[model samples]
Structure formats: C-alpha cells, structure tokens
Target: MSNTGKSLSDQAVQELVAKLKQAIATGTYQPGEWLKQIDVERSYNVNRFTVRSALSELHSNGFLQHVPYKGYRVTEHSLQERIAITEARELIECAAAARVIANMDSPGLQRLESLALEFRDALNAEDRPRMMKVNFAFHRCFNDYCRNPHLSRMVDELRERGVGNANRGWTKRSTQEASAQDHLDMVEALRDKNLVRLQALIHIHLNRWRQGYDSLSS
Candidate 1:
C-alpha cells in the first residue's frame, strides 16, 4: 500500500526514526542494546510492522545491526573502526580544504558565510535539526571543489555515519561557540588562502566528535 501524503503510518515511522536516531546518537540506547519490537511498539504506539520498518531504516543507515538470531540492536563501532573513519575523513577533508582554498570564489564564500551565520542562529534558537543541517551544508561547501564524484560520495557516506544527535551538546554553550568560531575561522582561511590554518581548523572541527565519543563511551 502507498503510504503517501503524510499518512499516519509514514508519520509514525518518521517520528520513530528521528527519536531512535537521536537516542542512539546520544548514547541512550548504547551499543548492543536490544531494540525489542514489543518495547518500541508500546513506546511509539505503533504496530509491530511499523516498528520493524523503522528499525530496518536504522539498520540500513548503519545505526543498527540485525544479527542472525538476536534480531536488531544498536550498532557498535570498535575503537579501530572509529579511528579508521576519522582518519579517512581527515584525509579527504584536509585535501579538499586545499582545493577549496585554491578555487575560492566570491559567491561560494558568501554562501558558506551565510550558512555559518544560520548555524549560529540555529544554535542560539535551540533548533537542533536546523543547526545540524546548516552545519553539514557549511562543510559540504568546502568539499565542493574536491572534483571527484566518487570521493565526494565517499565523504558524504562517511559524514552520514559520523553525524550524531544535534541535541546532544546543546547544553554545552562553550563548545557550541568554539565550533561556530571554527566555521568562521575556516571561512577566513579560505578567503586568505591560508591552507595550513584551514587544515588545522578542519582537524579541530572534526576532533570534537572523536573527543566527545571517547568521553561518552569511556
């Protein structure tokens, strides 16, 4: 059956997905927490089928695992896995930073600068989803000069995997300010063709997640 035009089923699944993704990202579900169908059905007031469908979406998105006999649980990334993802991201992003700097243009810079402002506004307004959306777009602006579609797609996939709950760190005002500064700093570096500074800021920007994850999981 077509669940089009905001059907009740589609809304349920969308709400479930957002809540589950936020829970998983913020470590509420933790690694290996069994996402019992009954629990989800009761909690979300959805049928078993809707819960299963929502879970399948999470599984496809690398947030959950469907084990042979254990059904579904939150996916766990080993230390090694995390490091590998971080390193791959750093490599691609740092290289892209250089290219972005080289190809820096007025229109692109304005767009990214505007996005940075929007991100700050989102944070100040406590709009988590908009903040994340703007932040992702800001970073994607830098990588636009990467040129290779395959590499860009890889970076995009890695980003999708690396993103966490936008609401997770809203209470940390200092961290948000620091991150906003980093984006503004990146824009400055691009305008000035300061590759070294741009690269350093990229590392700092990405390291926030690594450090936060380590602290949370450790």
Candidate 2:
C-alpha cells in the first residue's frame, strides 16, 4: 500500500477499535461474548485486516482476551479482580484530587458542572446510553484537570477496563440516582477546592459499581 493508503487503513483500524470499545463498554457486547472476525467485519463493514488489527489493539488494551484456536472474547473480570481495580482507581484518583483542584479553573469547573447536570438529566429520563456517555465525560473532564498527561492516561485506561467488565450497577434507579448525585457532589468539591471532600467522593463514586457487582454475584 502507498503511504496514503496506509494512513487510511490505520485510521479505519482506529475507528473500528473505538466503535468496538464503545459497544463493549455499553454492554451491547456482553462480557465473555466471543467476537468472530467475520461477523465483526460484516457488522462494521470493514476489511479483514482492519478487523484483525482492531481486535489486536483491544486485546492489548485488556478489553478482549484471545483464545487459542478461537477468536477474541470480551474479558470478564472476577469479583476479586473488580475489587482490586476499584481499589487501584481509588488510590490514583484520590491522589490526583489535590492536583486537579489546584489546576481547575472557572471554565473547567463550569464544563464539569454541565456534564454533571447532563448526566442527571440522562438518568432522570432513564437513558442508559446517554447516561454512560455523559458520565464518562463528567469524570474525564474532572480528571483532565490533573494537568499530568501520563496520570490522566492511566486513569482513562483503568476506567475503560472497569467499564468493559459489564458493571451493571446503573440498572437500578437508586444506584443511578446516587451516581448522578455523586457527580454533582464531585463538581461542588472541585469548585470549593476541597481536596479532602473530593477524595472521599472519588472513593464513593468508584466503589458504587463494585458494590452493585458484588451484590449481583452474591
């Protein structure tokens, strides 16, 4: 392929990767569901090479697991693994809370508040897909204020991994309401530059899904 062709192919692969990741994250592709390459190609209308490359990227990112003599399957985390991931997220996000507060400006705070309100509206309407998207935006916006690209990237990766594990905590109205409130509270904490309160909210927000997951497993 020519350089231009290569660039287009790379872009196609990246787009496919993002689409597949979103599908997996939103539970359209359930945990442990096998993703056949041909089906993926037909579904996404991509070529064989693109599908393979995208699957490989997702596997590298811990979103999918490759099976010998079989295609990729969505990775399903064990309860213990989910707990461990929650703990890790708590540590990283809480530690970054101070930096995020220090770096947060008026514009950033307003953006976060907007996203938080959007999330609450999505929750009220019982729009799961919109809720997922806005919830991610709210948290991502807050984390971006940490002003450390590497740390922010780490948080993104861990968050994607956790979301990929089919955290179904949001199915309950009560849980969704709590999450909505948590986002608003987090925004308030940032606005007030309350590092301690923000850290506490982070812990609660991160573990809410884990608690729901544990309940389901029990």
Candidate 3:
C-alpha cells in the first residue's frame, strides 16, 4: 500500500463530502454499488482514513448505507420505505410548519415567498439541481420555526435522507413541475396564514415525493 501523503484536513473532509454526495446523487456512482475506500482515496488523492470518515458521515446523514464488510452504497430506498419515511417526516415537518405560521414575522415569510419564486424559475427553466436546492431551503425555513433545537435536529436528519432519496426518483418534467407548484402553494398558504391549508399542502407535498418514483419508472 502506498502512502497518501497526509491525513485529510477537516475542511477537506467537508468538501469531499459535498463532492461525493453530488457524484452519487447524479449517478456518477450508481445506487447500491459498493464504494471501496482504497479506490476513493486513489481517485481523490486523499488518505484512506479520510475516505472512511467521509463515507461514515454520508451514511449517518442517510445518503449512503453501510453494508458491513461489503462497504457502502448510495442508498436506494424502496417505494414502501420512502412512503414510511415520508409519513414519519411529514408529521414532524408539518408540525414545524404550523409553528412557523404562528410565529413567522414579515421577513421570514418573505424568505419563503422568495424561495418559492426561485423554485418556480428553476423548474420553468428546467434547472433540476437548483430546483432541488430551493426546495430544501423552503422547508428548512419553516423547520427553523419549530424552535426546539432537538426537534429541529431530528427533522433535519430526515430531510437530508428523504430529499436525497426523492432526488433519485425525479426524472420527469411533469413530476418536477408538480413539485414546483407545491412550493408555490406552500408560499401562498404561508402568506394567507392558513394553517389547515398549509398542513394539508405539506402532506400532499410529501406524498408527491413518492409519486416521482412511480412517474419515472412508468
């Protein structure tokens, strides 16, 4: 085994994490394929320990699954699994959104509305990556209203995994458009101060995530 020069720096680990995430999400590394640490180190010119740490972080954040001695694979949760996870996450997220509606000041509401517009522009222009990012930001803004740090952390874990999972399934323009529409509706619901409508929209939005898997495969 050859030396990898030095161990990866903390900043470098974070950068690699983002790079590996995009590569896996974009299918540069296919779902369920083994990721060898030595290969990753060689490919990235990083230390083996760095590769392991990076993979471990991704696994914890739910982007990849560790297969014991078999190493890790980019996660590809089943439709049923997606449904279950979405159901669980929607409860926490919707509750947070309710709090957001109650507590949101003008500036926060403006942020959501801005994100919704960005989401629409991304979709109308067919910029999928930007669309996904804005989508994350929209919900994350609401989650901030929940206030309890512990609950916020719990929701964040699910959001990371669930959003990344949904990214895999979004391959159709119609599906993406529907997602963009949900963002628009969510912003309106916030602006209107309609708690019931907002919670319902949140449910439908979560359900739409599963729809992408069906839409793409069909």
Q: Which has the greatest TM-score?
A: 2
Error of 2 at 44 (Å): 3.5
lDDT of 3 by residue, 1-218 (tens): 32453333666788889778756644456667788898899888888767888999999987888987788988887767776788898888777777778878888878988998898898888787677667767777878876777887677666655555675546767677777788888878888989899899888877765555545344
State the lDDT of candidate 1 residue by residue for 3-32, as single tens digits.
574597788887898778756644456566
**Candidate 2 vs candidate 3, TM-score winner:** 2
lDDT of 2 at 44: 95
TM, every model: 0.66, 0.89, 0.75
Stretch of 10 with least lDDT, candidate 3: 1-10
Candidate order by TM-score, highest to lowest? 2, 3, 1
Full-model lDDT, candidate 1? 0.75
Residue 96 error, candidate 1, Å: 2.2
Per-residue C-alpha lDDT of model 2 across residues 27-117, encoded as one tens digit per residue: 6787899999999999999999999999999999889999989989999988778778878888999999999999999999889889989
How many residue-pair clashes does candidate 1 contain? 0
